[model samples]
Target chain A: MHHGPAAELGKDYSIEYKTRLGVILFFIYLLVYAGFVFIGVFYPDLMGITALAGLNLAFVYGMGLIVLAIIMGLVYNYFCTRHEDKMNKEAEL
Target chain B: MIYTVSPSAIVIFVIFVLSVLGLSFYFARKSKSASGYYAAGGNIHWFVNGIAFAGDYLSAASFLGICGMIAFFGYDGFLYSIGFLAGWVVALFIVAEPLKRMGKYTFADALDAKFDSRAIKLTAAISTLVVSIFYLIPQMVGAGALVTPLLGFPHWVGVVLVGSIVIFIVATAGMTSTTYVQFIKGGLLIVFSTILTIYVLNNGIKLTPNEDYHKFQTIPVVMEQDKILEIESDSYHLKTQHTEGGVTFVSLDNQGIETWWSLNRSGSEPFLEEALSIVTTADGEKLYNGAPKTDGRFYQVGHASKIIRNGQEVTETGPLGPFEFIEAIENTDVTRFLKKVFEVDGNKVTVFYQTITPGKDIMKPGLYYKLGDKGNLWSRLDFLSLMLALFLGTAALPHILIRYYTVASQRAARKSTIVAIASIGLFYILTLYMGAGAMFNGGLDMESSNMSAPLLAKTFGIVLFSIISAIAFATILGTVSGLIVASSGAVAHDLMDKYMKIKMTENQKVNAGRISAVVVGIFAIILGIIFKDQNVSFLVGLAFAIAASSNLPAILMLLFWKKTTSRGISVAIMVGMISSVLIILLSPTMYEIYGLKASDAPIPLQNPGIISIPLGFITLVLISLMTKKHRATK
Candidate 1:
């Protein structure tokens, strides 16, 4: 039937590698995100610290999490695209 | 109070609605098959679908409710904003591409991919409906709140109006029309909100109270001698005055004592004054309860009571930078208005008073949580649970997940989600400014926080008010249409086509979906009117809780864990959905809804994600392990 490489599900070498990268990025994002939440809940007074330009720590940190999501998304996309190209090239070879 | 019905607003609103209806009608012809109806034939441009993602997601809860919370309370509302955006992390990294690769049309298609079990289909369909309806109520409520001020229409008028229109949109051409509606509204919402934020910055923070504010706040009282001589405030003369104890005399409004009145009565129990109220009727008549009429409709509510510019209290600070605005506001005193509704002189009157709070206090958390109350522990827990629900729910919502199928491939799905995140994140950042702008400006309404953003625009001009309100209405239509599409797809695609194996031609399938959309749209309208008073953001939090608890565990297990059985998936779905709803229903907040004391409720916390989500995961793992051997033999 000629099911493609992407359809192999959990066993294809390239797909497994991409999945690993996704897991890593997910953890990195979660660690910072959860830290911001915990700090907000437990040490709320810390959020009051005007760490930058009259903006409180909470303000800066909350914004940091949002920006981080975009950055992580870009990095994942770049590497996955590169890897997909490589796998396709190898298949042709 | 800043709201007034504008001819221009009515014009813009009609134009906006007619164009949306036009788009839906055009798409109706393009939706030829079941696939075309359900997913726009999976040929949508990734970029278009990406913006459409933003349109589908930024519901009334995000726009009106979050903005209102920030305006009325402060930074706590941004907590919801951040939590909601952070959820895309899960969606992008894990769910997006894989979900696209697996699912054909409905979300149930993805979950039922491996086992192809009717149990999974039925449970998933039921879960989709419950979550969709839960989410729909808030959007409808937000629509109702907007209608009253925009057109002087009653709440039900708005509810039924939006309900009927959205049903028509969905029934005509399911996803094609739904996507276009979302895309146009999504793009317009961001653009208009940005313009509003920019206008707020240019205006800066003005300390000018309404002209009638002083007259209403300060009542003149005349005292003749040491004996009870005379008292007149709000037209009530001295009934009788006496010195009860060793107290000599006190003056109200001593320029320092923080309260509204100063009396020169002797004793711990100084003579109490008659209550004053200010009510604005539905007919634009402003009645100072027990007093004369004031032509003003809305007095400024949340504003910097005192602004210190260059070490002196200033009348106005004009044109500050975005960073400078927040800093200057933090250094000032803000007047937070409180409203009280009571029966007086055989009439229902509402009174609003300004409480002076430090600006630093306004810019921080703990305002919304009420940490000082007897239910302090529960309130804190509930707060955490809400954040969790919002964070998890983004990856779990059926409408959101189904968007992946509208695009071409796994790669397209991933790229489109990233695009959605960028635009949506920028919009959320703008929300903080918009919320603060309304708060510091005089357009806040304590009784209806949902009016904050639109009311703020009215303060700028009637034209901007009309346009912003019209866009806000479109935002409701877009989100509701998307939710209805997802629900109808679940019913027709999963329940009818797959589970029941009802062999219908492409034409028949589209018909079934149209029927489902009509039924669900009506249900949404009724629920919306019933929950008219709840803050839309809070209702959205409950919806997130249900999605996080029910759908997330099953989807995550199915994709990653090979041992996950169909039985486990069904059990987990039922448990996650039912337990979350049951807990939410029994919580103190629901008890209050039932007209019972919060203290008398069975549970303390208002949020259900903390318990129900973990139970979903635990059930999935345990049930999967037990059913593994049986599945292997089969």
Candidate 2:
């Protein structure tokens, strides 16, 4: 089982950095997504209010969560790529 | 229930299946080594893999189930979409990069990478098999649903057809062909769904009554509770019914077929005292709820019962923007069918009577979620558990997790996941419009909610319906293939090679995988046939619950916690898989499957995620503490 270091496989990165940002963003996303579930389950009446056009709060909030997921994904990708690259460059030096 | 076969749909469907088989044969020769067969030699492009992620992830549940749910009930079905899409975030940000860097063939590879232990392999492999089998059921069920209208085949034939095709796909090039099929179908599904949606929007909301159909008058007659009385109608007596051994059996007319009606004691659904319906078609043929003795007519199943425009009742509303369209519908009247079995002329008849539901009520919550049920703890927990399972299940699904291993690098995995999220998110948005459009399309099949989307496309024309059903069929093929490939890898690589320590030749490994694919394929087909008429949405929910509870905890713990021992991971995986499967079998849904009363179920909730998932986490933590001596010795 002994060969080159396992880090060479691209698994080595700043665990602290990734976990910190990942947990933070994860909680933020869960909070928003959970909000959608809670409102629908508990406050059924609020979802009926046609928020805009014929789109009710139910539709708006759900769509918002979906759109937010994309935005959050792009955000995470950007920061994580930059952070990982910086770590790899430092590791090379 | 007599769904006439669309010849055009059959032609297109056959062509699609043939092309997919051709692609598989070509890829089969291209792949040589076991590595090549299992993971495509890790050479897949990020973009293709990303789209394939969407393809495999969407499954029949996303396409058929959500759309059908929305068409029947309202926006409540879209909640499943939000939960499913949100799961990819956990995949992309947390699981994808780490998994790709560590694992080779299966999800078990990642778990066992940290500790060279047989327990991890055995447990993870078992989890993969259980989850994949559960997932395969809905895809098979969906295949049957699509074939009923398109190919004019019975549901079981459709199940077997998909099973055989998916087995051939996996047994050939394994992941190589599976990825390409997913990529092609994933792209086609979105493109065609968009085109169908655009056509629906262009046509706008229109009230077009069925040429042959006529509404029945509800004559409320006072009758004795236990006495059998005859309420005569024009054509024939309603279908007869009798209660024997606590099961209410509605004996259909010589021409009528059996259909599952939601058996509930709660009078939430509508019922009439005198059930009378006599639908006389233009050709002087007698019909029951718009179906004849011979070839039945497609009744106006999902039409808006009433439409209001600018405070006035109007039959036609011209083309409107997406938001405006929903707004118009909110204030309008949607005539949705509510089914109830009643005695007429001493015969029990199950009539799907039209109810003019307020558009506002349809547009809001509580249609399917029962959100207003404050007193029911089980209802609240069940709803939350289903959403939780869907949210967590995506990251844990064996078919989905293996896609990361097909790519070259961790970054590729993350990028691919992001692509998947974008594509899947857009498709879900389109599903809302499609579902609502189908709801009032006046062409939906009431008996099979899974047929809602394809039947809606039928209204556009034969070509559109054919293409939609064909794409849906391909969607099932792609998903089932990916699942079979995953299960095969678990059997050949993880369980046999790693845990059993077979040390077989490369050729033998590939042979083992092929054999497992066929066996699993046959098993899936039998299950598909047994649970023929199950709603795809509910079946998919069970699959998600099992996957989330079993696989997610093990993967998350191994990645985040240093003290996570091999014993802990194995225990967590086994406990999660077993408890979830046990809870599912004991749940109310299973009680229904047992042909027993819902009240007979020992478990209050149908979903097992809330109970089993936390139980998995607790077991892992406890076991890890007990086995912490190994960590300290190291």
Candidate 3:
């Protein structure tokens, strides 16, 4: 596949940067899931505490996925715009 | 029904109305462009939009219906909460960004983005209006229900009051005021519900034995050659019988009777303390709480308390966590409960509580066809089909789909969805406790399960009762506004401007949308008043089924299926829309709504998603194949 215009622009700028962001997001999801499992297994008493009240692990993980999707979209947009501008300049040249 | 209208409830109602009107007036100036009116200029913050999503999604059905169900039916009501939250997964993962990228304002915009077809636009717009109206009925009914107890006004008065207020809100500000109102109300609903759940857990369960409660008795008499027969409480019966019956009978003892009994060591009590004691005596056999009488005398049929696992009793060593509680219930016999029924003399009195054990086939829908036996395959499939429709339908809802356009970019759309999921998911978890708390709180109005949560709050105090009820009303307003906006956008943008080729500037388009909003709001109010007595959640479920059948197939096909021509999408929408609506209108639900006998129903039941959704996809494929050559030539 061509990786699309967006992906090409990301590569030209720094593939390493995008990869790092992805890795960070993956870890965030990992942390949330892990936290819930820990609470479920060890600190069971704190499961429904009012302080932690509405913050369930499943919810945190779900929210993390949402955050990751948005970040991905933003990265994709940035690359797509840059690539489109560059392509237009090259055509003019 | 014997409720005194509290001053606080009146004040809160007035304040809410005024605040909404104020916001409407403020936004009225800015809502001159179509984008501003329909999409709030597409510049709302993700956080606000996310909460507004909660506001739009959680109507009377979510706030009142689930809670009432839980109060009356125990865990069964909470199952609805789980189902609703599950549907959000489809919206977040599957539809969020793609919808944002595709649509301008309405759900039809996304489906017809590539096609630019008049048929698609008209069909999709009509679908949006129909679904919105269906959903509005329940909210309006809920509004009327709230008014009876909260304001001491009649049900129709409540419907008209809410209808007028909502119309003003939508007509004045369009989406802008609705969004903020929803945001505020959504936040309050979550906070107050959490507080109520805390109160419930802290109070814990209480043992209310059959004794120590007042029981009312009714005596029936035959008079005037059995033509002017009458049944009344002893106090009223004496007077009526003397005048009407003109028959000398035994002296009836008239006194408010109270019985006192102790709870068994196992700690199980009758469902309703007062309701349980008035057992029906048949052939000198006293039936206590619907349980079979052992001797031909009054005996205490105490509730047996045991920690049940799966379908059998188990021992709980100590307090369990939430998930653990769910697990325990899943694996144990903790599901059995004492039920109450009331009946008259010589007839099996339905006025006693019977111990109920949900059968193993409880999870399978339509398992109990004739009440005792499990339902057959068709019924089971129908239930699954309804659930499938609900699960996938959220992403396709016109109101929900339009929310994606409120944010600026696809990334923002995705992020806002994530935030919504988190917030909504959190709130749904709270609903479980709130529902369960209401279930066991002994404050449920059995006739109307939707009153469970609010009535539960009333048990605490009128202040909380007023606030919770008001927030619940706001919940309906928020959702109704979102739906009106969606329908109006569909009419003004997709149908009138796009399909009908009406040339209009942004200002004119905005005016058209505003006018449409008023019209839709009026229609919604009328339907709401019409369906004032039906269950709100059931109505919402029908809306979901329609949304899934009519919109999901076309949306999914356009995004993923390349061969999905414009003709295919248009055909799928039309088929889905027509079939689901027709099926619902002819189904058993319509029998009651349309005042017809059950046998007169054209379809088996109201839920038609199982057959209709698949039919929509199949029709699209066949039509696309037939027109493939024509499409290529064009």
Candidate 4:
């Protein structure tokens, strides 16, 4: 049976490579997110501590999660595009 | 509680609705083919689709509900924003590329691509319809909520108006029109919210007693030898006195108008606190502030009682940065109103009295979520379950999944998602400032938290208020139309053509979709009217739980697991959807909705995500193994 995705990303860009990188980045974000939730649920007093500047840990950590997701998304796109371009040219040669 | 209909608001609202309708008509000619109607011909630009994703994703719940929650409850609302934006991470990293490559038009197409299973198509189609309806109810309820103040219409009128407009948009141009509409809405929502945030920061923190309705005036009571005597007032005469629960409430009359005031004693000094009340007599007559509803006497509430900066109580902090605004609120004493209802002498009285909450408590969790050592295990588990649902739900939403097909290729889908993450992430950050702004400014409606952001805009000026309210209406319209498109595609493409094997021409398929949109729109209006009193954000959280529990496991397993048989997929979906919905219906929240005691509910959990999500994964794995062995025996 045919396998992997139906749409071709590039001539030789590895699906395994992209999926692996994505899973790793996803797990990294998940770990950080779990920390926020853990602190919120179990150690509610900790979220009130001043984390950065004058903002409370709840505000700082909450805003941090949103900012980190955007940065990670851009980073994922940047690396995937670079690998896709290089690999596709090599296959043509 | 009192709203004066502004003509300018109605005019601006009409123009916004007209322009959105005009765009739909302009795109109608291009949506003739089934492909164009369903997937926008798979030709949307990655940048536009990305912003459109933001437009489609940020329903009235995001803009109105979260801001209101933060305004009233503080940091808990921002928790929703964090969880919501985090869900997009799952969308981008795990779901985007493969979904774009596998599916043609609907989410069912991707699921059934491997085995061409009719059972998969039917179950997925049904799940899409159920989730869309669950999501649509809140948008319609939000539409009704905005209409009452902005247009001075009844709640049902707002529901019918949004349903009709969204139906026309979806039935005419389908996804082609929907994408452009969402793009415009997404752009307008971000720009106007940023403007509102700027205004909030510029105004800074201030102690506003909201004396526009009635100034807070107290008179010393005349006492005779340790005995209580009547208080003297030049303009008001004491009319009636009733003491209940050790608090003496006296009705005071000024000319022909009357209102309730409570007696307070500090040491040996006695004073009175002014209050606002809605009284309904046994004769079935309603009174606002002890007068007619149209007396225009209800005061605008919500302002800082004391603004403390560096341990010094100040009248106001003129201008502050975004971080400074939050930091300042942390030390302030905000004037919040609490409502209490009771029947005295067979007349029902609801009194809204002032409460002083420190800014530090306002920025913490306990106001709404009930966490920490003070909260029980059930409450903490409920909070975690809701966060889990919000995180996993975004990737599983049918309307969001359908947007992946609107882009031209897998690369376009991936790139567009990054754009959505950035756009939506910035908007969520702005919500924190606006929410705090609403709290310290006189912008809250004691009756509904959904009106906080718009009413906050009113404090700036009527023109800014008009523009912001119209954009909120557009927010509702954009999300409702996207839901209808997803629903129509499920009916025509997945259920009828794929599962039933209906041999229909392109024109007939498009006709079927239009019919389905009309039906779904009417159904949404009915539910919106029925559930008008329910909280907008709470209903949305339920939608997320259902989607995450039912659809996410099936899609994730199909993508990552080789042994996921078609029968396993079908049964897992049915079991997951039923279990999540059943738990929600039986949970304490629904018991409260049913007018029963919450403690009587069999299931103690408020949210079903933690249990149902794991249940979905386990069921899928177990069923797949058994089905594989059966196939081998055959």
lDDT agreement of model 4 with the native? 0.86
Q: Highest lDDT: give the candidate number.
A: 4
Docking class of 4: medium
After the best TM-score superposition of candidate 4, give how far the Cα of residue B49 lies from its true spot, in angstroms: 0.1
Runs off by more than 4 Å, candidate 2 = A1-16, A88-93, B209-293, B297-300, B341-349, B373-375, B630-634
**How good is model 3 by TM-score?**
0.73
Sliding window of 10 residues with minimal summed lDDT for model 2 chain B = B257-266
Residue A46 CA displacement from its true place in model 3, Å: 28
> What fraction of the native interface does candidate 4 get right in terms of contacts?
0.51
TM-score leader: 4
Model 1 off-target regions past 4 Å? A1-13, B1-3, B209-216, B220-300, B339-352, B371-375, B629-634
lDDT of 1 at A10: 30
| Candidate 2 per-residue lDDT over residues B441-488, each given as its tens digit | 765566678887887788888899899999999899999999999999
Shift in Å, residue B627, candidate 1:
1.3
Query: B1-634, model 4: which lDDT tens digit per residue?
Result: 7788999999999999999999999999999988888889888999999999999999988999899888888888888899999999989989998787778888888888787777888999999999899999999999999999898889999999999999999999999999999999999999999999999888888786334634656766665643446777888787777665656677778888777877767547876778778889999998888778677667667778888887787998888988898899888888777666667779888777666788888877777877888789988999999899999999999999999888877778999999999999999999988888888777777777888889989988899999999999999998999999999999998998888989989999999999999999999999999878766777888889889988999889988888888888888888888899999999987897798988999999978998998898899899999888422110
Name the candidate that leads on DockQ. Answer: 4
**Candidate 1: deviation at residue B398, Å?**
0.6
> Scoring model 1 with DockQ, what do you get?
0.38
If the candidates were sorted by their lDDT against the true structure, best first, what order would they fall in? 4, 1, 2, 3
Which residue segments of model 4 deviate by more than 4 Å? A1-12, B209-214, B217-272, B629-634
Task: Tell me each candidate's TM-score.
Answer: 0.89, 0.89, 0.73, 0.94
